[model samples]
Target: MTPLLEIALLNIRPGQTEEFEAAFAQAQPLISGMKGYVRHELRRCLEDDHRYALLVWWETLEDHTVGFRGSAQYQEWRALLHHFYDPFPTVEHFVGVLP
Candidate 1:
C-alpha cells in the first residue's frame, strides 16, 4: 500500500515563485524516478506568500528513506533547489487512516 506524504514549504523570497517552480520542475524527474513513488501533487496558496505544498504518494517509507536519501538524485535535487529556499522546508509523513 502506498502511503501519503504531505510536505509544506515556506518559500524564501517574495518574487521567487518562478524560480521555485522551475527548480521543482527540474527536480520532478529525479523524484518521480525513485522506487515506490506513486504520484505527486503540488499546490500554492494564492493568499499567502511563499507558502507551497506537496502531496506525494509512495509505496513505503523506505522508498523515501532508503531509496531517495541514498540516491545521487537527492544530491542533485538539493544542489538545484536547497539554496532558493528561505528558512528551509518542513516535510512530514502520514499514514492512511480513512478513505
Candidate 2:
C-alpha cells in the first residue's frame, strides 16, 4: 500500500451539523469513485456539534494532488461542503510511524 494519507479537521457552523452531513452524504459516493482513492471515514465529535474529522487514505500523494484536485468532482465536493465550515478546514497528510 502507498504510504501517503490525509486527515481533514473541520469545524462546522453552529447548528449546521445536520446540513453538513446531508451534503457530505451526497458527495461521499463521488469522492469514493475518484482515481487513487483507497478509503475515507467521516467522524463527528461526540460532544461537539461543530467538530468533525475526515480520514482519507489514498494510494499515493498524487492521488490527492493530481487526481482529486484535477477532477471535476472536486468542484462539486467544494460546492457542496465548503460553505458549512466556520474558518475553512485544515488538511494534514501523514505516514504511519508505528504498528
Per-residue lDDT tens digits of candidate 2, residues 1-99?
655679998999998899999999999987899888888999998988589999999988888988998899999999999999989888989988877
Off by over 4 Å in 1: none
Please give, for residues 8-28, the per-residue lDDT of candidate 1 as tens digits.
565657788889889889999
| Model 1 residue 91 lDDT score | 80
Enumerate residue pairs that collide in model 2.
none
How does each model score on TM-score? 0.88, 0.93
Q: State how far residue 39 of model 1 sits from its true place (Å).
A: 0.5
Flag regions of model 2 displaced more than 4 Å.
Answer: none
**Per-candidate total of colliding backbone pairs:** 0, 0
Per-model lDDT:
0.81, 0.89
